[model samples]
Target: MNINSWNFKKDILILQKELFDSIAPQTAENRTVANSLLLFLKYSAKCLFLKWLCQTVENLK
Candidate 1:
């Protein structure tokens, strides 16, 4: 995939980190939240992409 595209894994990771943020009440808490955020982003990203594709196809002639 093109580097400029949102579908790139690197871009996803970067965005995930940015979205997750590092500020937390403790180190372990930050780590746990980070892991959960990563999983959430991965699943949500795939699901959203699939939904978008399905909708686009449904709109086709």
Candidate 2:
């Protein structure tokens, strides 16, 4: 709910959008590679967000 948390979420969203945009225009030959890279980014982002959420919750206690 705070400014820092808001900024963190915004940054994550921007990074995700940029990643998706970068991979969206690849050739068919590179589709497999792009798919894997996108999957990796998605999982990494989820992990990062979860970690941040945990820390934020801990700070509130």
Candidate 3:
């Protein structure tokens, strides 16, 4: 990819890492909430990506 795309991806990775690092420290009550939301987001993203990939593959076929 071009420098611009690389820069954008780098920024997103940095942000994601920063967010995880910041959320790692959970007191007591916010622990479950934090983990649940994180997992939900992760799974939702995976499902959406897989759906998109399937569509792309079907189109190619």
Candidate 4:
């Protein structure tokens, strides 16, 4: 089959739609990763503070 026989505009539109569809999931995934990273940072800071507090208490004993 000749490439010219295909509908070029329609093919381009389809490809564009597919590209957007594929990208949509990545956008959602990025949001999830960002949220997870924030949670991790918060938890890490809390843990560090607790550890430091415990060490200080032990030092006083």
The residue pairs found clashing in candidate 2 are none
Worst 10 residues of 2 by lDDT: 20-29
Per-model CA lDDT versus the true structure: 0.84, 0.93, 0.91, 0.95
In candidate 3, which residue ranges exceed 4 Å CA deviation? Answer: 1-27
lDDT of each residue in 1-61, candidate 3, tens digit only: 8999999999999999998888776544498888899999999999999999999999999
lDDT tens per residue, model 1, 12-50: 898778766664346778799999999999999999999
Model 1 poorest 10 in a row by lDDT: 18-27
Query: For candidate 2, lDDT tens digit of each residue in 11-56?
Result: 9999999998887776554888889999999999999999999999
TM-score of each: 0.51, 0.51, 0.52, 0.70
Tell me the spans in candidate 4 whose CA falls farther than 4 Å from its real position.
Answer: 1-11
Of candidates 4 and 3, the better by lDDT: 4
| Candidates 2 and 3, the one with greater TM-score | 3
- Between prediction 1 and prediction 3, the one with superior lDDT is 3
lDDT by residue (1-61, candidate 4, tens digit) is 5666577867998999999999999999999999999999999999999999999999999
Q: State which candidate, 1 or 2, has the greater lDDT.
A: 2
